[model samples]
Target: MAKKLWVERNEDGSWDAYSDDGAHIKFGHGKGLFNPGDLMKVALAGCAALSSQFPIENALGEGKGARITVDGDYDEATDGYTAFREQVVVDAQSAGIHGDDAEKLKDRVERHIEKSCTVKHTYEVATPVTMKVKVITK
Candidate 1:
């Protein structure tokens, strides 16, 4: 079973997520090139790439490796929403993978990402959320 991860940020500006077994990731809000939200999209893309690996390999038996990349396009002017597009390129010399296989793999990856990715799933649903802030003078 996968370990449950718990994430926290300290007052000193450090961040980390710990699992039951102590495995975790360390990073801060401003420490990376992009924020945690951006990393969420990257993780979705990474999941797509990794999930498609098996299909690609099976389609290209004893074939050369191929590179698959997923990109997300956002429209901030329209309420900060984004669409994800995946690009997959296969080597011509590869033994099993072909144009058709690549197309099928792309579709499979798309469906998987839409349904399985945490960020994507969250974005697809509408949740009732509200925020309240109180200011105190000392």
Candidate 2:
């Protein structure tokens, strides 16, 4: 299925981006909304977080004290992300995951970080994007 989005330019110069699922967002400088580039950061960060979730849960199970977070640091000059800092804060005493298990956890998480996330792969490698333009007049 192909998903579509529609964007409208407001009278005040800010723009509203609408999704196919009745979702709307405003974006522009000083518009207090996320610009398109910022949204890319969001996608990368969110993908990283989601990609890491499974490994953490699989290692420790779905219980208390298994918190996973991924924050992407964006490089403004390069117009891309410089780093994605991941924090997997688990309470060792509560979760009963310790010793060699802890050692193995890092490996599992790292394996998934770069390999699993689709968006991260797209950003890392050169994926050609081509566009064609046509003008329609009434």
lDDT by residue for model 2 (23-110), tens: 8888876758777767776677677667777787776676433455556777889987677655655555556778898778877876
TM-score of each: 0.55, 0.65
Off by over 4 Å in 2: 22-25, 60-96
Per-residue accuracy of model 1 over 33-136 as CA lDDT, tens digit each: 34565666667666655555555566665443346565666776874546766565655454554578657765765565555556545656775779787899
C-alpha lDDT of residue 55 in model 1: 53
lDDT, candidate 1, equals: 0.62
Residue 120 in model 1: lDDT: 47
Single out the weakest 10-residue window by summed lDDT for candidate 2: 62-71
Candidate 1 residue runs with Cα over 4 Å from true position: 1-3, 10-12, 31-34, 61-93, 99-119, 127-138
